[model samples]
Each structure stands twice: as structure tokens, then as C-alpha cells.
Target: MKKLLAALVCSLPLVSALAVDVYDRDPDHTFAFFEFNHLGFSTQRERFDKVDATVTLDLENQVGSVEVSIDVRSISTGSSMFNQILLSDTFFDVEKFPVVTFKSTKLNFGKLDDVVSVEGELTIKGITHPLTLTVTQFKCAMHPMLRKSACGLNATGKLRRSEFNLGRFAPLISDQITLLVSMEALKR
Candidate 1:
């Protein structure tokens, strides 16, 4: 533990220096959607309409970080009945766990350009678990309409819903969940 502590202590300066670009999430452009198999017939998709997030990056260092907050009540499935079922105690239990969150712990860079993995802890249904988001597309420039420097990216990841206690139907409904996150942020 001492060596681990020493390593972390030594990395502080690098971390502090790498916080070059700070951004506020663009709600209109950001989306966090998920997919999972429903029974054996087909796949179901849902998304949370309300999400708040902040992202930062150090391009030269190939490092980045993200923090996100998702309003559980905002989860939508197009059908009101399905939405209500998802919010019930057997699923997300939105009344007891009103929010879902993710905060980065580390950044892993790929050898190829525009590819990096964000390691983070995700909390859902009041349970926290580790997750990684692989950035597939990344771009930054001035937004013509808003005239604000902005960055946008799409990331993908997978998780086991059972880990978060959202395994209502279990094997039948499929425990694995896939995530597709598209986020755009403006410089703060």
C-alpha cells in the first residue's frame, strides 16, 4: 500500500497539468442510451432524457476524464407502460435511486489516434461498479451557432445489469447491457 500511495502521490503533478480543457456538457447534444435483450425475441432500447456531465481532456497526453449525472426519472422507452415498469422496485427503482452517476478514475490511451478508454465507477440503483468507455469518435472545434469552442465524442461500453441489481428478469431478459454514449460539451 505504501508503494501504491507513493505512486499516486508522484502522479499528482502530471494529473494537475493535464487538466487543460474543461467543458460543460451540452444537454441538447449529449445522450446516454442503452440496449439489452428482452426475453429471446428481440432487443429493447431506452434512454435518459435528462443528463448533466462535465468532461476534460489533455490531447497531447492522450488523457481524458468525464463525470456524469443521469436523472433516473428521465428514463424513457417510448411506451409509458414500459417506462413505468423500469422505474418500479423490480427494475431501477427510481423512487429509491433517483440518480445514476459516473466519475472517471483513470485514462487509458490506445496506440491509434482518437482512441482512448475512460475507466470510471458507475452508480446505478445505489450500487457502484467499475466501467470503461471506449471513445470511438472525437472532434473539437468552434460551434458555428453558439460560437463556443466545443468537443463531441461517441463512446461505447458494456455492463452487467445484474451487478447493479437491475436483474429483474435475469437470464430470460438478458443480464448484459450495452451502452452508447454521445456527448458534446462547450468550453467552460
Candidate 2:
């Protein structure tokens, strides 16, 4: 009995080392942005101010999951008129669906333990669609100031606004929208 107890105690560190790590999104550094072409003139970019997410990573298994929630009413378009229009039923319908969400279905990793792409379902205005976000930049290390393990990633994906029933201004405002996500998460 003492031998078994000793063995279990010795294996505790190994078991904990193989466990997954959870991280909480740092609101100050995480943001979700979208850009669309405007009447073939230029691109208009806007961001959601309120976003929250939780990430779990198992480096040993090269598996991870990300779940993000964005407040639709927190749209920032620089102009109050634009923000109001986006929040209305024509676009986001904040009254009916105040939150947008993305839940990961799979996470592809590279040889260096970096995420290559994230296959997930993106929900907007209550409509859910499968979207794959390509990770362009990613880094996981000890934060200089925070003094904790952290990860920062930049990912982008394209989606059609029409698919989500937000196609009020199709060709003129562009139905294709580029979704950009920059997030920093600290170990929990």
C-alpha cells in the first residue's frame, strides 16, 4: 500500500503537466473588427468594443478550443448614425440578438505548436454558419509586463453578409465582409 501511494504521488506532477491550460481573454487587448468595400470607393472598417472569450490549450496533445462572444450593441463605426443603423434590425438586430458568438469545432496546429487555422461556427443575428479562420500571426510566451504565460493571435476570415440576413445594401455596400480578430489571452 505504501509503494502504491508513493507511485501515485510521484506521478502527480506528470499528470498535471499533461493537463490542459485555460486562458481568459484580456478585454483590453482583444478585439473583433470587420471591413467591407463601400460602393467600390473604399473599405469601411469597424470594430466591436465589447468582447469576451475563453481558450483552452493542450500543448501536449496539440489541441485547443476557443469560444468568443461579442456584444452586437457595442459596434463602433465612428459615426453614431452608422452605429445605430448597424444595431438596427436591418443589420445586427441587437434587440433580438444582442450577442454574436464563435465556437471552435477544430483547431489545426503546426509543427511548432502554433495554430494554423481554426474551424468553427460563427453565429450572427441568430444565424449560425461554419467559418474557418486562418491564423496569420500567433505567439505564446511569457508576457513582459503581465509576467504570466499569454498568447496573442491575429486571425481573419471572410463571410458574406447576405448569408446572415444582413444584406440590406448588397452590391453597393458589399456583401462580402472580412472578419478580423486580434486577441490576447492570459493563463488562468
The lDDT leader among the candidates is 2
lDDT of 2 by residue, 1-188 (tens): 99999999999888966688899999999999999999999999999999999999987788899999999888999999999999988788899999999999999999899998999999998899999999999888999998999998999999999999999878899999999999999999
lDDT per model, in order?
0.88, 0.94
RMSD of each: 6.6, 2.5
Cα shift from native, residue 49, model 2 (Å)? 0.9
lDDT (Cα, 0-100) at 142 in candidate 1: 98
Q: What is the lDDT of residue 108 in candidate 2?
A: 97
Candidate 2 — which residues are off by over 4 angstroms?
1-18
Weakest 10 consecutive residues of candidate 1 by summed lDDT: 107-116
Q: What is the per-residue lDDT of model 1 for residues 99-128, given as tens digits with 9 covering 90 to 100? A: 999999987866653646788999998789
Among all windows of 10 consecutive residues in model 2, the one with the lowest summed lDDT is: 12-21
**Clashing residue pairs in candidate 1 (N, C-alpha, C atoms within 3 angstroms):** none
How big is the positional error of residue 89 in model 1, measured in Å on the Cα after superposition?
1.0
